[model samples]
Target: MAAEQGKVDPMHQFAIEPLFGSAHWEIAGYNIAFTNSALWMAIATVALWIFVAGGMKRELVPGRWQMAVESFTGFIDDLLEANVGKAGRKYVPYIFSLFMFILFANLLGLIPLPLALAGVHPFTFTSHFTVTGVLAILSFAIVLVVGFWKHKLHFFSLFVPHGTPLVMIPLIFMIELVSFMIRPFSLGLRLFVAMMAGHVLLEVLSSFVIDGLNAGATFGLIVSLPSFLLMIGICALEILVAGIQAYVFALLTSLYINDAENLH
Candidate 1:
């Protein structure tokens, strides 16, 4: 149902609205003010800075904070080494950066801010294609540049697997080429859709429970209880999804780099 008459709109949370007063910034009569999405992005960037920098101190005896940071970093390091091998260690910092930024962006969206704030800026910019797409493009660029830089013409061999019959080579190359070209889209879409869907599901479920309670019937209250519990479960699952999506993105990046560097 449309939210025009005060109905719940799960998607309204994803809208892009002006960050400040209207008419403050415009071009040719079109309002182009800074958006909440932009503000959240800036916030995420600042948060990343504070967390990473603050946790960089090397303590003689690591405190809980220090240990937590070290553990997270070690996990990222292991992910890189597992997917991309020893040479991949060189890209650890970059991979770790990608993972943490995405992980935080996903988690931030789960925060239940005021309805007014959420309507203007949900703070889960990663749920938007533009943000995720940019990251995907960056990953694609790294793979492309590294592929060509390391292998020259041999990089094209990535589109052709080994141990293939001569007759099937042409068909296989086309399939691989198409898959390779759309990596960025797939990478970004996976995260963007997953984040958006999880949030929307939670909102829709919560609305159902609220509507049930408002019905003023004993059965409504009982029904709402189960729905409420389900909503809580979904929230927990989204938290897990947030981490998994970030890991998949980073792992895919590492695998792409590996393929580019060590192509068959």
Candidate 2:
């Protein structure tokens, strides 16, 4: 029981550890460690590929699986079209991939897996700022490049309102530029904060249940019942959050692109 108390650290799951234990290596004078975060990222990528690519087919009369896949495709298509107008057609594939990858990464952490093999751990990539920061930066870069490619110097006008006073123009530009630069960090932070909080909450609840069961008393079991039920409810909520965060990330990216294109 003391060992269990020692092991039940809620924030321990977020720690990034090397895959090769202490057998560390360096390439070109840089420490290139294969961490648990990398393992789960690769897992999420392969799972996404198997799910989406393996399911592709050509059939006029679609089966249930095919229908579900098509529905997802159509849903993303509509999202792109609605948010970015006709120009958004080119971005459907990118947005769809981003959404699915994030959804898979977020949900992978909720699974209670024994990852002790080969120096691995249950990792939620999206819960880490490093992972989410890269994703957000990539999306922001795409919006910036495409905006300038399509509109050139006119893209700068995104900061200025349609009818701003001459005196306020410079102030508005500074404000807008600051907000624009903050978007990627904010996007990444939002996902990381939410994922980290949910997982920690689950960990704390599970620890209580564990302690109760270890007690081996009727009252312990009785109290643990409600804790178990609460964990179940939290699991369901986390699932919903997983999907919603993916959708929200994609939606916000699309909206940013829309603003860049239309300058509103």
What TM-score, computed on C-alpha atoms, does each candidate reach? Answer: 0.90, 0.90
Q: lDDT of candidate 1 vs native?
A: 0.85
Q: Which portions of model 1 miss their true places by more than 4 Å?
A: 1-4, 22-32, 113-121
Against the true structure, whose TM-score is highest?
A: 2
**Distance (Å) between predicted and true CA of 120, model 1?**
7.9
Q: C-alpha displacement of 211 in model 1, angstroms?
A: 1.4
lDDT of the candidates, in the order given: 0.85, 0.86
lDDT of 2 by residue, 1-264 (tens): 334555578888888878867337788888778887888889999988877764587578887777877888788899999999998988999899989889999988777645545545668989999889999998999999988998999999999978999999999999989999999999999989999999999888877887787778775678677888999999999999999999999999999989877777
lDDT of 1 by residue, 26-129 (tens): 79987667888877877777888887777788987878777878888899888878877788888888888999999888887787747546553456888899
